[model samples]
Target: MHMHVALCAVLDPSEMPGGYRFEAIENLVLSRLDRLPPFTRRLVMDPLGLDHPHWIEDPEFDPIHHIRRVSCPAPGGSHELGRLVGRITSRPLPRDRPLWELWVVEGLAEGRFAIVAKVHHSAVDGMMGAGLMVNLFGMTREPAPEAPPPREEEHPVPPEPRPSDIEMLKSAARKRLAQPRKLVDLAKRTVERVGGVVERRRDPELAHGGTPLTAPRTRLNRPIGPQRDVGFARLSLAELKAIKAAVEGAKLNDVLLAVVGGALRRYLAHHDDLPEVPLVATCPIATGAGRGNNNVAAMFVPIATHLAEPEARLEAIQAATRGAKEEHAVLGKGELLQDWADLAPTTTFSVASSLYSRLKLSKHHRPVHNLIVSNVPGPPMPVYLAGAELEAAYPMGPILDGAALNVTVMSYRGQVDFGFMVARDVVPDVWRLADAVAPAFRELRDAVLGAPSEASPERSTPAE
Candidate 1:
C-alpha cells in the first residue's frame, strides 16, 4: 500500500486553560464528538488499537501517529515545538495501512492547544481535510452529545511484495512510458480547465484566491524550509469586502495580499532594509476538479505594496495576478510535480528534511521555496457534524531548513483566519508576526475604501 505522501506538519499551539494537559485536550476534542464515526475514526485510531508507542510493525498500518502531552522548557517554547514537528514529519511512513497522526501539544505561551495532525497525501486532499473539520466540530460550547456510530468492520493484514532488480527496471520503464500519455492527456485537460474558469465563470463554485497569475519576483520568493514557525491573524470578511468595494477594481484577494505586502513592507522597513524589486508570492490554485492527488499548484505572482500608494499596490497585484492565471492555464500540475520528484526523491527528501528536526543539520543544501503562502476556502455558512461548534479554523503548512516561514489562511463563514508557521530560530516572536498581519489588513482596507492608512506601506525586503 502506498503511504500518501503528505507533509502536513502538523503543529499549531493554541491558547487554552493553563492547567489543561495534552491528553486533556485530545480527550476534550474527542469527547466533544457525538460518536466514534465508524469509517473515519477507525482510521484515526488504528495506531492506538495496536497499542504500540511506535506502530512501525503493522503491515496494514496507519501512517499518522499522534503523540501528546509534551513540554518546552525555558529558552525554548516555539523553537522546541518546531524541532519536534520537524523530527516527526521528515521520516518516511512505514509500509503499512493508512498514513497519518494527530499529536496533542502542551507548554505554549498562552496555555494554548497545539494540534500536529498529518495524513498521507493520497488518502486525504486539502479541501477534504477542511471539509472534515466542519463535521468534526461542535455547534455550541455546550453541544448535545450525539450517539456514537457502530464500529467499522476490521480485517486481517496482507503480505508485502519484495521486488527483484529486473522487476524494478520494468516498473521504471513502464512508468516512464506512461508519462507521454499523461502529458497528452494533460494537454487535453488544459483546454478543458481553461473553459471551466474564464469561459465558464458561470461556475461560481470555482475555487479561487485574490492574487493574479503573473506576479513579479520578490527577494522573499526564494527556496524554503522543512522547519516552520506558525502564527495566525483573524479578520472580518464583511469589512474586507467593504474595502474592496471602496477601491475600484480591487478584488478582496488583492486587498488581502496588498495587506500582507504592506505588513511585509513595514516589517522590513523596521530593520532598515527594503528590496529595490517587488516581492513574489507563490499561491495555490486548487485543482480538486475530481482528479487524482495534489490537485493544486503554485501561481507565482507579485506583491506590490512596496509601491508608493496602496492604490498602486492593489492595481499592481491585480494586473500581475491576472497574467498569472493565463499562464497557469497551460501548466498542468501532475507533470510539474513529476519534474519536482526527479529533483528530490522521496527517501532523500525525507532524510534531507531531518535537518529541520529538533536534531542537528548539515549546511550544504537549499530548500525548494522561500516561503509558502496558502489561502483555503471555507463554508460561507456555519456547519456542524459531531458536536462541538466549529469555533474557528486555521490552515497549517510544513517548514524546511532554508525557508523558515509559511503563511496559510482559511476563510470561514464570516471571518478570514491567517496562520503563519516559522522556524523558531528565525522568527522567535511568532505572535509578533501575528501583530504585523492585522494592521496590514487595516492599511489595505483604508486604501481600497479610499480611506487613509493608519500608516503608509513601508518599503522592506525579505528577512536577510
Candidate 2:
C-alpha cells in the first residue's frame, strides 16, 4: 500500500566551488521549506476512527528529517549511486511524518554529485513531482535571493479551529447515507460509458486496440518480493526525434516504445526467455485533473518484440499506440475508473491489498499487462539546484505485484533518460537490460537514417 515515486538527478561539479558541501545543501533545503506548498507539510490518516483518511498539517514537522546527505563508495560511479538508490527505494517512508525524502549524495567520480528525491505517489503524480522540482530548483546557476513582497502592517489572521472527532463522524455518516443514490448514478453512467466504448470498438477503423486479458504472460509478470533493484540509461533526444521524422505519424513516444521493445527482445533472447508473442506494456497517461496527484489513466500498448526487424517493430508499435490513444479518448479521460475508485471503501482496500501481498495472489491469474512503460517530458533547458548545473534526471515508478518491471523515461535538455526498477530476485541483472537500450536505439537509428556509422556512445550514460 506504500507506493513511492522516486527520481535522481546528476549535477555538474564545476558549478559549485569545490563541489557540493553538506552544510550548504542543508542550508539551501531549510531556506526553501517555507516557500513550499502547504500540502508538502501534511500527513494523512486520522488518529480517531471518525472520518476517512485525510491530510492534516504535521504538528511536529522537522525539515532535517526530510532532507539528508549521504556519500557513495570511493570512485563513486553510476553503479554505486544506483545501488544506493535501490536501497533507499526499498525502505518505506515513515507514516507519522510527511511522505517525502530528499538525499543530497556526493562522491560521484570527477567531483560530481546527485540528488535523489522520493515522494509518496499519494502526494504527487509524475507531472506534479516535476513541477515541485522546478519550484525547488533554479533557472540560472546563480539565482537571485527570493524576496518577500512588502506588506503594510496589519492584524494577523486567526488560526482556524480543528474539527472535533464527533463532528467529523457526523459529517461522514451523512455522506455514507447518500451512498445508495450515488451508487445508482454511478452505475448508470458506467453503463452509458461502456456502451459508448463498445460502439467505438465496433468501428472497423478503431478496432486495433487489443482487449483486456489478452496480454501474454511472461517472466516479468509475476508475484514480487519487497526488495528491488534500479538501473539507468540515457539516449539522445535528437536521435529519437530524427527517427520519428523518418516515419509518418510516428511520435517521440512511439519511437521510445520501439526502442524499449528492441531492448527487451535482446535481453530476453540472451536469457532464452523470449516469448513468441509480443510483450504488452501498460502506459500511464495523465488525465490532467485530480486532487493534484495520482491524476493518471493507463492504456495497454503491444510492444512488437516478436518482430525481428527494427523498422517493422517501430511501425507496429506506432500503430498500436495510436489505437490505444483512440481507445483512451473514447473512455473519456478515465472518469469511470476515478468514479469507481472514489466510492471504494478505504479499509476494505487496505485489507485487500495487504492480504493479496501476503498470499501472493498475483501469481494465480493471467497478467493484465507485462510491465509499465511511462514517458514524462521534462525541462528542455538546463536547470540548476543551489548553484549546481543539473546534467541529467531519471524518474523511477513503483513496481506492482503482478508487474515486476517499471520503465520510466524523462526527456531533459537534449537527452532522454530511462530509469528501470525491477524485482531484485526476478531481475538481478537489470543493468544488462538498461545497457541494451543504447544499442537498441542505435539499431533503430541505423534503420531510419539509412547509414550505419559509429553511433555516438557519448549520448548514453550506461550503468556500470
Candidate 3:
C-alpha cells in the first residue's frame, strides 16, 4: 500500500511546569527539528523514470509551512477528534516540500491538547517513526537546559545541493549497468527459497505459512476511497501480560492477535458475513537491516477468527505464530523482499499502482490478505513532550486497496493503545469495532483467570 502514517499524542497541560499555551507548545515542537534530517529534506524524482527518487536538502525549507494549528470541533471528544484526523490524513502531503506534517490540535476536552504527527511511509517505518517522535520528547516534565552554542569550527556539515537532470541520468546509467548481475542473483535466490518451501511442506510437523490469493473474500476485500473512518481503543498492558501468562508458550503478540481475532469474529458475525475459514493478517516485522527508511518485511499469519471460543483462538494463534517465526528464520531476514524490490524501477511501481487503483483491479482478483495488524514498541516510562504530560498515544498504519482496514497497536507507559483506520464506505460505525476490544480482552481474561468477583467495566477511548 502506498500510504502515510499518523500518530496522535494526547497531552495534559496541567502537568506542564510552566502552564499551557498553544504558542509555547508549538514553538517547543518546532525547536526540535534542527537535528532531524527527514524534516529538512525533499524528495527529488527522476524525470525520465530511470532510477529511484532521491532525498535532497530543501534550500527553501520553512518550518511554518509544515506545522500548523487546528481547533477540534464541538464536544471536543474522541469522535470529534477522530473526524478531524480522518480529514487530515485523507489529503495527500504536498510533494513539493518535505513529506511530513505536524498539527498542533487545541480545544480537546479538559483544557488538554494533542499533537498529530504525519509522515510519509517512504520516510519511516513503525520503529523509525516511533524513534523520530521520541527524539522530540524528554524524560521529565521540566525541560532540560539547552546546550551551549557551538564554538568556532564546531558547526555541522553543510547540506548537499540538488542534482541536475544530466547528473541524475548519468547516475541512473551507472546503476543500470550492474542490474543484469544482480538480476541473475535475485533469480537464483528466488528459486532456492521456493525449493526450501517445497521441502518444508514434506514435514508433517512443520506448519506452512500463508499463501497469497488464498484468503477468503469479505466486505473489507475491495476497492477503497480517499475518505477514512478512525477509531481508538485503550487496553491495559497488565491485563495483556496476564493473558499471555495464562497460555503456555504464548507471547504478548499472540495475545494481541487473539484479541483482534475475537473482535473481528464478533464484528463479522454481527453483520452475518463471517466466513467458515479463518482470516489472514499481514504482520510486519522490522529487520533493522534493510535499505531506506522503511526497513521491514511482512509475515502472513492465519488469525483464528473462525473459532468460536476465545481461549481456543489464543492457542491456535500461538501455534501459528511459532510456525511463522520458524519459517521467517529459514527464509532469512528480508533479503529476498529487498532484492526483488531493488530489481524493479521506481516508475514501474508508480505506474502499476496508479493503474491498479484507477481500474479497480483489486475487486476482480483474490485479496492479498484480510487486513493489516502492526505491533509497535514504545516508551515504557511516562515521557513528556516539551512541558505537557503525555496521557495517550495512538499510531495508525496505512490501508491497502484490498485490505482497507489497518489496526496498529502501540505500548506506552503500561497502556496498549489501538488505532483503527478503515475505509468509510467499507466499514461504517467503526466505533462498534473499537468498542468490542474491551469485551474481547475480558472474555480471554475470564477464560484464563476465571471470572472476576467484580466485573471490570469497559474502557473508553481517552477524552471520550
The 10-residue segment of model 2 with minimum total lDDT is: 148-157
* Candidate topping TM-score: 3
* Local accuracy by lDDT, each model: 0.51, 0.79, 0.83
Clashes of each: 59, 0, 0
Candidate with top lDDT is: 3
Candidate 2, residues 117-195: lDDT per residue as tens digits?
Answer: 9998878788877888887787877632343222211111222344566666676677678889999999998888778
**C-alpha lDDT of residue 157 in model 2:** 23
* TM-score of every candidate: 0.63, 0.92, 0.95
Query: How does model 1 score by TM-score?
Result: 0.63
User: Ranking by lDDT, best first?
Assistant: 3, 2, 1
Using TM-score, rank the candidates from best to worst. 3, 2, 1
Where does model 2 exceed 4 Å of error? 17-19, 46-52, 143-162, 452-457, 462-464
Candidate 2 RMSD computed on C-alpha atoms after optimal superposition onto the true structure: 3.6
Per-residue lDDT of 1-464 in model 3, one digit per residue for the tens? 43899998898888676677666765665566665668878888777978888998776776667888899997789988888888788888898998899998989998878988889998889999889878877787865334323332111225588899889889898889999998998898888876787788689987766766788999888898888878899988887887888778999999999999988988888888899998999999998775888999988888999998889988888888877777776677677888787778888988898889889999887889999999999999988976788988999989989888999999998889999999887887788888889888888888877874243355667767
What lDDT tens digits, residue by residue, belong to model 1 across residues 65-183?
Answer: 43345554433344455455455554544334435555554454444334555555544555666655555443443332232222222212232443444555555556556667776
